[model samples]
Target: MRIVVADDSFLLREGLQLLLAEAGHDVVASVADGPAFVAAMREHRPDVGIVDVRMPPSHTDEGLRAAVDVRREWPAARLMVLSQYVEVSYAEELLAAGEGGVGYLLKDRVSDLDDFLAGLSAVAQGGTALDPLVVRQLMARRPDPLAGLTPREREVLALMAEGRSNTAIAAAMVVTPGAVEKHTQRIFAKLGLLAGDDAAHRRVLAVVRYLRAAGG
Candidate 1:
């Protein structure tokens, strides 16, 4: 896989480059600031981009804004953002860009190389990989709409929001695929999401609803 890394921290940026290279992936470009990150994206068009939520200048949301710009200009760009804290608004903004190929993880997660790499891989393959902490924050912020759901239903919906497929959700929940499908249907109905023949579209709608209800 080809990757582009953007972070204001010199040590973290260099460490990521070395880490990806050691993992047999090509680090096409490593940049420091948001503008350079955008330029690298246009020039290299890497398979996946790993970006810090904050960058140079204000060290505020420069990297996140760059990610949004890249997504706008290049809709197919896959992005995995690392943040020091769980910001529901930022996660909402990132998810609002599209259905999949996006991730929002906390910086602490970087120490778990396997999980971090898996998240990037998932995003590159057109899937979502939100950090568990972010999910919990979102869930904790608003619980009214979800209050109507059964505990089992809530569990299934949470995994759906994480972009898990039915099979994956089933395996994780230790249930059969048919049971997973049934739970998904109930979730959609309870959430008032329109029933559709397109599975992916329905899944996206469900996730969007989940995020919105969670104060995203």
Candidate 2:
């Protein structure tokens, strides 16, 4: 995949460039701040971009704001935002900006190279890849939407929010794939997601609803 690395830290920017290159992906552009990130996105039009949540001058939400701007100008642009901590509001804004092709991962996760690469790949393929910690924090913030779900179904929903596939959810929960499917179906029903809707779309909608209250 073609990509861009955006962060105020020179080390992080270069680290990501090198990491992506080693993974056999092209790092088309690397920039230091939000404005430069936006310009690089326009110039390179990479498949996905890796952006830090805080950058430059303010060190608060500039990169994320620029990501939102990119999505606004080019709806198809994909981005994976890395934050040092669990910033639910930032995740809300990033996810709310587009239907898919967006990710919010903690910086710590980068050390787990395999997981980080998988998350990046997921986002590039037009799928959501939310950090597990972010999902857990969001769940703790809001229990109202989950009132109708059973305990098992809730676990399923949490994994779904992490952008896990049914097989993955099953493995994580030590359950059968069919069991996971049933739980997901019930989650859809309780969430009022149309049964006829695209499965992937419904999954993203469910996660979006879960985070929607975070902004409030």
lDDT per residue for candidate 2 within 157-202, as digits (tens), equals 7788788999999999999999999998888888899999998888
Give all TM-scores, in the order shown. 0.82, 0.89
Model 2 has an lDDT value of 0.85
What is the Cα root-mean-square deviation between model 1 and the actual structure? 2.8
Computed on alpha carbons, the lDDT of every model, listed in order, comes to: 0.84, 0.85
- Compare the candidates by lDDT and give the number of the best one: 2
CA shift of 70, model 1, Å: 1.8
Off by over 4 Å in 1: 144-149, 163-178, 188-205
lDDT, candidate 1, 1-216, per-residue tens? 999999999999999999998889999999999999999999999998988988989998999889988888998899999999866676666776766788888988789998888888888877778887887888787654767789999899889777667998999999999999999998888877767556666776677667777773
Candidate 1 positional error at 190, Å: 5.8
